[model samples]
Target: MSPRAQPRGKLANWGSSFLPGAYAGSYVNIGSMKPDAVIADLKNGSLNRSEQRKQADLLAKLNRGFLARREKDAQIEAGIEAMEMAFRMQFSVPDVFDISKESQATRDLYGDSEYAKGCLIARRLVERGVRTVQLSHSIDGYDIAWDTGHGDIKGGHARLAKACDQGIAALLKDLKTRGLLDETLVVWGGEFGRAPTSEGKNGRDHDHYGFTVWMAGGGVKPGYSYGATDMFGCSAVENRVHVHDLHATILNQMGLDHEQLTYRYSGRDYRLTDVHGKVVKDVIA
Candidate 1:
């Protein structure tokens, strides 16, 4: 998917694109406000304590009513989940993002880029019960910068890979040390891969025909590569895994059957993998 598709403005739109109504209200941009300020505001909002209690009581009542309906109402359940998450985050988010709490050696292991910091934050979040965390390699705040199409691929890819490699390595190592790697899934890839053929002098154009993605932990076999590109690294030659398959495998790792995990919208059900996806069982442990 194009980075342009991702909204840079409000969190609602972004959440809708990825998870629809499920996370719209739970959107928290760690980049926007300091965790301390967010916690403070949540505690000392315009509403007084009694009013807040009443509101919480009302929400609980509504949630019970929604649960009694027996319909798989994603919007209702998502709203309830969002409210609960928001409340819990008031206490958890601050400490989770505080990298200063990490040892100096751990900090050095991950390097010192915003992206690297995000990787560390991801580990912390996962350790604290966040199920999913995404860390992208983008020089700018947006994801489009990873589209390396122009100028020296050697130097450009090297610089980009250096930070990503260090951070991901550190993350995997940290998770393993804490015995979380077995339960946590780590996936690394881009929207598309660069073509093997040259673009200008050293750069390469986007190649949607074939690319590579790797998975670690979460039931995947360790140190085993599943597929292959041609000798020139242009296209997949065997054991091809489509993006849908990737999604299915990830959901499978999280104990969710991708086909069954659907949300109702406009009188129809939609899922992350749509109507297609087969779990690549060969890669599983």
Candidate 2:
């Protein structure tokens, strides 16, 4: 999941928080509302600690009416569950982000960029048994991180590529050395690719029809390339994978059937791959 893509509303914790009788939710994030800051909060009782309990109490009180009426409320239950998960995470998550505990050689392997730091952090998170982690790189005062917009693609892409290349390489190496790669899936790519045809000056626009996503470990064929675009890379000409198809393939690799795994929401059956999606078996090891 992209930090830029997270919904900043009540549904924000939908993916990170799993509720009873809910579907498809995962682990908590470090430094998230109070990720990595839990210890300090507990020590001082600063806003997050004292204030959190107050909020939890208020929510329980509000939800009491629904419970008294013999009715179930999903939103209230989800919020309470999320709060408990966040509080419990403080114990295990803080150390996961502390890359300073890593060896000097390991630090050098990831490079010095901010993105590199994140790569190292991600590895640490995984090592500590965090199943999923998402890193989003951004430069202050800039709206876009990797999207090279209507600016200098040469300068922008080069810097981005350097940071990503070093970080990704180190992550793979570190995971393999630690014997975590085979079980941990590392996915690298963005929502879309840049258009080959620059709409203006020296920059291109977003191109979703044709893009690339790379996968490693977790039973994928190592050093293999799948699918292809046309000469101009304008559209996916061969073995095109839609977003839904991609979801299905990923779930399949994770040992789940996209079609079989369904969640009930709003009194309707909802599949992760939506209406149609099939596993691309070619990419599997």
Candidate 3:
């Protein structure tokens, strides 16, 4: 009962943490927590020091089985298979990371590289009934994957773009071919976009003022573009869509009312839109 205790937002469900969205599970840090303790410790960081230490040790063992070079092959494979099965129980694709010969064509079409492989895998996941799939540009914890301006923009983008262009184009083409495009939503964008004014060298810096992000399928009107930037592409000029708006539009397409999709916690309701979202009707069918 203090003024500072005023309700600020809506409540949310603990399980909704698994919900798919823009960055679907991006912020989770499983570094020092065991798989069993993930949800519990993540939500309530009040575990005793001893309990925390135990969790950390379990996590270390799990990491070794998955990444340690000295670990036995049998142990690693077993761990992987178990994890795959667990993922299957919740996700539509029971195989989790299973790859097939038929996927070779899809992979090649996406570019036959890691990026392409990932995109191809994403296509497979969505096709198998997964609601949302997110593929980050980072190949191996290297931000340089997309932070091209750091050095060699031409070479960097060329290497990455070859795969990206193929993967994205193939995904769009494949989705349409199979009629999955209507039910599946595809989003392509990053935290922000690169600046239009070349870094005066080769690459460009981050430009939040204006950038480009496109969405296809999932009830979105095809061949229709949204928003525009200035001549220099430094700022949004017309029909600018904010990130919150994008989230709103996505939730809408999923048949969830952004405002009503609430989770109750601590006597309040919390929703992803968080008081700021307008369904961009123009972008929807």
Candidate 4:
């Protein structure tokens, strides 16, 4: 099964009393509420909470208002205002909004696609002081997405590879150009790689035994490939980096000792790497 993108579900709980400058739809957690009840609450201004709950409530109310109005001419205007407020609360900005369109040259450089846009946006967000930015290669648009084995492995991998190559290359180049590559880590990979063998009808099943992932900058050794897979790419043959090892490596980059970063839970010290993890010394710069 494909891992869930986010464990928190569709509703994100900001839980902060203060509103942020910007927010995504994923930032609000609206529990069960009937249309009538939602409308009544919004009209009464009972949705405001002292903490982050207010942010969630605001989003819920805005959505309810939009639906209640169902005004053909007023829909766009209403949504625009809601977005302005939502962005202000989520991102902590007073009135900043993304209004400019990408130029032809910029679009061409980034491949003129959503995935590319996402990669480019990641750089922008991080440059603006966002702690972390993740660019997920989702299976949308582009007839040939990952999960190559399902139909034409070659076709899917080709599309995915091209997009990744262009998008990742652009990100690295931009980060380097801005001198952010040294501190900004870029990871490219999937949960697992496709199987080496073909299914009965030309599809490939999930194989967790071995896969490929890449990391650039953030003090990671450059042009260096770590670990190896067997001839069939079915099993890790050398320098195996388990999922825990990856976690430990990430923690080490952030200046936290994997063994020392622990939380007491259930009367036991729980760590990100659990009881297993080495610093992955060879990969560190």
* Model number with the top TM-score: 2
Which residue ranges in model 3 land beyond 4 Å of their true spot? 1-96, 140-144, 198-200
Which residue window of length 10 is worst by lDDT in model 2? 1-10
Tens digits of per-residue lDDT for model 2 on 1-285? 222232233244345333352332433322232335423443324556667668767766767766668577766566656656655555456666676788999999998766677688788878877666766555432325676766878788887787668988999999999999999888877778888897778888888889999999999899888889999988999988888888898898888999999878668888877799989889889
- Pairs in steric clash, model 1: none
> Please, what are the lDDT tens digits per residue for candidate 4 over residues 1-285?
001132222223222112222332222111111222211123224433354456656766777677668754334444555654544444332111131244576557767555666676567667778666555454443222475767777777777677657867888988998899999888777678888898767678788999988889999999998889999989998999998899899888888899997766558777868899887889988
The whole-model lDDT of each prediction reads 0.75, 0.71, 0.62, 0.62
TM-score of 1: 0.80
Task: Quote each prediction's TM-score.
Answer: 0.80, 0.80, 0.66, 0.67
Superposed by TM-score, candidate 4 places the C-alpha of residue 250 at a distance from the truth, in angstroms, of 0.9
lDDT of 3 by residue, 18-123 (tens): 2322212212212222233212223224765466556656765776756667654544544554444333343323243344444567656667555555566667
Candidate 1 root-mean-square deviation in Å: 4.4
Lowest lDDT sum, 10 consecutive residues, model 1, at 1-10
What local lDDT score does residue 151 receive in model 1, on the 0 to 100 scale? 76
Supply candidate 4's per-residue lDDT for 195: 83
True-structure RMSD, every candidate: 4.4, 4.7, 13.8, 11.7
Compared with the true structure, model 2 gives a TM-score of 0.80
